[model samples]
Target: MFYPLRERISTWTTSQQTAEEETELIQRKRIQDLPLLRAAKENDIHLLKQLLEDKNCDPFQRGAVGETALHVAVQHENLEAAEILLDEAPQLINQPMTSDLYQGEHILTFAACVGDIEIVKILLDHGANLHAKDSWGNTILHILVLQPSKSLLCQMLDFLLSKDGGKTLIDIPNARGLTPLKMAASEGNVTMFQHLIQKKRKIQWTYGPAATMMYDISECDSMEDHKSVLELIATSSKSQAHKILNVPPVKELLQKKWQNVGRPYTWFLTAVYILYMICVSLCCAHRPLKPREDNVTNQRDITIYVQKTLKEAYLSGDDRLRLVGEIISVVGAFILLLSELSQAYIFGLKYFISHNFWRDPFNIIRICYSCMILVILGMRLTDADGEVVPMSAALVLGWCYIMYFARGFQMLGPFTIIIRKMAASDLLKFCWLMAVVVCGYSLALYVTFQTVDPQALGAFYSYTMTLISTYCLFSNLLNGPANYTIDNPAMYSPLYSSFCVIAFLLMFNLLIAMMGDTQSAMAKKKEELWKAEISGATVKMEQTFPKSHWFCSESSGNDFKETRYISLEEKKWHPFHLEEASGSSSDDESDEDVPPQNSQERNPNLDPYQEIREDITDRAEDRGNVDHNDNEIWEEELFEF
Candidate 1:
């Protein structure tokens, strides 16, 4: 074929390759050599030896990732192959990988990164330079600081410091202007944070505030995580708190301010929700005669045909209003769900998990309200032309949504606060006791009524209904609708009377006493309760969302500026001991002068280790229960949101 003329720029490309280099390049490009590379990575001595004997094979040739056979071995932590490669060509120790993950990363850097102590020892013994900076400007110390397995990170850091003696690597800043200390602070590693503070605290306040240290506060996962960042910045920093706060511009995001518009907005939602519910109520007023017809039969075919036609006519013609209401409810629910998701995204997912969705009681209520509507949507999708479950869902949603305004208004907040405290305390215990007693009595009545009055109270559901109806009498939700408490007095008289005595006279009165004790206890802390309610109400208002994103998105306080502070290393300051907690255990005091980085592991025999393990176990058990006497059981309350 006659080829067209193409632009030839040999000067811009590498057209001057030697015969041996050209062959090696071809070998490097072949996918067939992947098995050879894999063998080297797996440290298969026999296969690797065979590959090494082939002169045409370039053992040190780069792959598509710009990694050599030796790099693969070190990356895979194959000490055997790495040793053989080092023996063959020691110069490869300083060669950098061109891969993005390990750009300009030498052998010792990768070894220190993976915490392969053996390979690190070998490379270090071969005069591998510890002073070399990688693409991230991290020394061995910075690479190891954030590792979850602190033992290896700790060991490498301690070893490197001991060798350097001056610890110059400790304060070296990266391209992002983040020193090892600041990066450690953002991780919320209390032990690492405290260790870094102890190592570098001698620097004076004249260095200005270290706002960069706590830059990750918005993304923190737990309240304790946020507190850890603040503790390091506010309590540990030698700089004044006001000056230190200057870095991140995060104070506005932290403090949720009250907006009066939230109340009106909530009422608007209430109106729309109520309108949709009213339509649903009209639909439910008339139901198909043969509703919930899972299993049914009739003797006369004509009679069956007539019944089916009447049922279909009733459902298809009259339930149009209900379908419209359901559609509107679904739309409203969808909008609320989207609003919740957007708000959560803006606040940061971890922060939303810790504070808004999990901790805020009203937020949980709103989520539950939306979920009930979702269930109604699913039921409608299933073409459930029934009235019972949908009606029950609407009733529950109406009351649950009140939680939003209940927390928002100033007057209602106090009442809700008392209810919350009662719920958190006495109501929780009482509900458990009530459920157990109800279930026990329900089973007994089921057997008793089956024998005496099989028609009225024959089914298990009948006994359950009567027991629940009598139970509701205690809450004043029902007065005297015990199905047969009056009609079949012989069957229901003893059950009703006994239930009243046990549930109302005993359990119900005990609940009131518990509530009184809780109320009295809360009354002693009314001032604190008022303060918390005020803060919660403000959060509720802020959560209403602004008509414009200008305040949140355009404000200068929304983000940090790109600025770097000078490190204290210029003045050559050294770290000293922090004040130990008083009444410290002998083990703690003994280890005071010793940096925590020096201790690879805690003493298993010590009470501190035992106590921490026990605490974790206890918290796990408490999380499995609904009650929250001591543990943070409320964290698990929102099963889904």
Candidate 2:
């Protein structure tokens, strides 16, 4: 009894498992019938209807190719059949056909290729994905060209183009890298070829096999097609292909313009030299001195001592005076040269720094010169005996500065415009200019004291200390470390007051204004150069016209010939001599021909030439009626010439 019960349980389990397996197999068969049902392929539809009518049938079936019944109907050029199936079961249209197997030959691809415009419209209306690429990466347009019907292909293209068109067909390449246009050319489809040519006028035949294939197609039937191909090939080979391609012409033009502008190395040097000279002049202009006593006793004592000292240490001849003058001039010139060299170096350094060179040669030279000058000043200030004054060092540094300035000036000779403009300006460029002047003045005071009394090194040292303190005050003011007010009451002494006033009015104002003016002028010149560059670019662009074949057609050529102008001007293009060509005389023309004259031409009393004379007279009368303020109008008229 137990064995019978176990056998019965096993039999029931086996039966249930068989039923589930059968159901799965039936579902799989229904899925496989989907593409056939969609394509309206008769046999597939019969099988689908049979499955649907039966209680065990699956209406939502997909085929081996992952295509549903609707996909098959659309693909098989059966739009009516698809519509019937969709009306019966609307959800089927929304299902995405599996793309794994069919590649570039999906349902929509089939519809587009087969010229089933109605089916495509229905699918699109049902929210079919237009941008969907097939397994082989072919778009609807790509599939359309594969069809034989030219009219249908054109219709499909027009429909796709109607919404957000002007996209390049060349972007879609087949497995072999052949564009749709190239494929059309290969198939000797003149209509498709011409359509693509018109659309993308600048399209080139660069793909090797595709180009050869195009040539082969053109040669298949007649020499005329071959000639057309040859002509296209010839045009592609020409240098004007770049122009035809509509590429900008400014880059090449700019390169040529820069070459013509020449090198700016020399101008850089000149600017440096001028700056150096100004610095030296500023340095030499003022010197620190001890206050002189005016009282009778002190004056008599000082005078007697100075006279005895001068008598003992006097130079014998004009040679010393001449030598001194020469040295001063040399020093001044050296300072000028150094300033100019530094400026030139600054300008050149801009270009060099772009290439990652951080060190500027001119700046280094300036720093060295500054250091040397400081050393000399230190020696003069510290040495009680004045035995190690480093006169040779001072002279050497001065001469070096001069040589640098000269070299800079020579380099900048070609930029005469820049130099003259800068020199005439009131811009203060170099801070060192003032520093040098102050130092030179301090040194001069030391020299003067030495001349007065050969053993006055201590007095000279005190004066140098005062000069250093004054320089420090100026430096603090410039650096904004301290306010520029003269807080030190000692600076209010009559001697210091006069020097400060002179320095402010003469040196500082003049130098600053000159530098400002120079900068403005240089900026203006650069602007002019930029304008010239733009103009050159415009001219280059004009010369590169005729890139678009549409603009080079027979009608365009004729229009160009008639106008004799490169750019289209509406007023110029308006036809003249219309009445004469129509054989109509002025008298014979009705009121319609003349119409009513506008306000500008309504004066009937004025003859053609008399009207012109009257206009001039009216303008003169208007001028005569104007009021003058401070004789401003008269001055303007006088200067009009």
The candidate that achieves the highest lDDT relative to the unseen native structure: 1
Error of 1 at 50 (Å): 60
User: Each model's C-alpha lDDT?
Assistant: 0.55, 0.45
Best by TM-score: 1
Model 2 lDDT tens row, 269-380: 4465556445444433322222444555643364311111222222545434433543454564456446545645854756544321222243344545555555544443
Task: Tally clashing residue pairs in candidate 2.
Answer: 49
**Candidate 1 lDDT over residue span 522-560, tens digit each:** 666554344344433334433355436213332212222
Candidate 1 weakest ten by summed lDDT = 203-212
Give residue 196's error in model 2 in angstroms: 2.7
Candidate 1 pairs with clashing backbones:
none
